[model samples]
Target: MTIASENTTVFDAVTIDRAVRLGTATLHEAAGRIGALPSQIARITPGQSFAGPAVTVSGPPADNLWLHRGLLASSLGDVMVVTVGGHHEAGYWGEVMAVAARSRGVAGVVIDGCVRDSDALANVGVPVFARGLCIRGTDKDPDGVGGVNEPLTLGDVVVYPGDLVVGDADGVVDLPAARVDEILDAADARIAKEARIMAALRRGETTVDLLDLPKETR
Candidate 1:
């Protein structure tokens, strides 16, 4: 499903933050627990964990001119999500961009390519997720692409604009727009149930007894 830019709405930062605080596991389990198809590309910069509305970008591999332009055009509180056609050869994000983004009130960046300047990024406190770290630099020309606010494939899943995205130590999960409320409710219920189970465990209840499993299963 290709989402058109005109149809895409970048959600408010408050909304995304609220969703993140709700509970990571609940958001995942409610969304059927589908993980991002790509494995471990995003590195959360120390002291830079954040959730916000997505500003999606798409461009050619190994080029980031468009990304630079996107940064300039992105609004405050937007999380710049760059899809570099899964290019992992060169670093598309670096300390310079992170600094600029922070000044612009950008939430963070999620790139399908690579990033560099890890120490600087950590020091500057900008969260970044990428395929990996690479010292290889990207060309500013010949590889520039377009930014369509539409739903673009990141890793293995289609991320629609305005859909909730929560990323923590566990991983990133894309929440379906229609199911956000339902998932939040489910998460609340799950938390309540877990609380009771935790109390029982504190009282020396075994897993079998807490879960009501049979002796044969235990």
Candidate 2:
């Protein structure tokens, strides 16, 4: 029977932590040039990075009814992913929400729209990434509803519930939990290849020579 539940499934803590420790950029490379969120989604507060499974949500331009539900529905280590139907002018998330999320052990929040309370958010103790900040508040529209654990897109990547989400100063990225091991393996190879290139440079080889750039291009 079909049923509704607030609980969102997630990957193991160790797997997610390892991906977070690997950083978003490496995962992008590992995932074969995919999984990086748009550059427009940026860190509002500095010095914190996070990795966790997504709990997707969305709503209209300035209604945050879904976000309120997301907080109630989220579990420890679940990162809230909000897409506001291309609305980038509402402060749908802020200090109050950040505080609530932090208390729930929510890893972080990524919003396609705007947010506010930058200073207050800085002290809220959870990382937040958004398109920009706005002081305008959202409406508690009774007509508004948002889905959780659904697929989400951020211009640069698509994310699903339980997908590994890694974010930092570089940006955010998503990887299907089932593909984590394979992607990490590729990342390891890429790192090794870069290491070899660095070693060659230490031997006084020019980058152009090591990379074999076209003579005319150099």
Candidate 3:
């Protein structure tokens, strides 16, 4: 069910806008507080964030050729979600790829591996979320076991092509594209509820009182 009909639009402008506004945290809450990728995968550019349909890529350890293919296969507003078979030290992405991605209108990237060229990546205007940075380069093995636009499991979250991928400073979360409307509705309600709670806190209500937790016993 991850792959949908070719006629189905990968993502809509309105949905991307709303999802980016709500952010990964709110959408995760709306998704029953699940589908969060590993916390180690975080934003490389401090203020940058993105929300777009995923173009999942699975690459072999220490190899990045599939990522290039994934980038080529993607259209505007696609987020490349890649996993590199537990190889965390290779610099699988860098400034050059960031420049190319920005030029092609890729919304962002989330990889379960490392990236390098911090200075240029921070300036290239593409939001990248990865495990960490590394100086070691990667290979482009033609015989490597990898595929573009395939399902990938990063940590406990399963990412499939066309799923909505949202990433912010907190982390990344995958929301099912088919449930975008439902998730948005629930996120709206949660925001309203949290707003009321914030108002209550400003009025001097304690967390225990607001949440109705049992009183502490000596």
Which candidate wins on lDDT?
3
10 residues in a row with least lDDT, candidate 1: 1-10
Q: Rate the local accuracy (lDDT) of all candidates.
A: 0.71, 0.83, 0.88
lDDT of 3: 0.88
Ranking by lDDT: 3, 2, 1
Worst 10 residues of 3 by lDDT: 1-10
Clash pairs for candidate 2: none
Q: Give the TM-score (vs. native) of candidate 3.
A: 0.94
Kindly report which residue pairs in candidate 1 clash with one another. 3-150, 3-151, 41-130, 42-129, 42-130
- Tens-place lDDT digits, model 2, residues 1-218: 11126545666777777777777898898898888889999999888888887888877778998888778778899888889878888899988889999999999898988999999988888999999889998998867666666676889677887777888999999888778889877877878898999999999999998899876844
lDDT tens string, model 1, 87-132?
A: 7789888989989998888776888788899888887766787777
lDDT tens per residue, model 3, 53-145: 888888889999988987887778989999999999999999989998998899999999999998899999999999999999999988888
Choose the strongest candidate by TM-score.
3
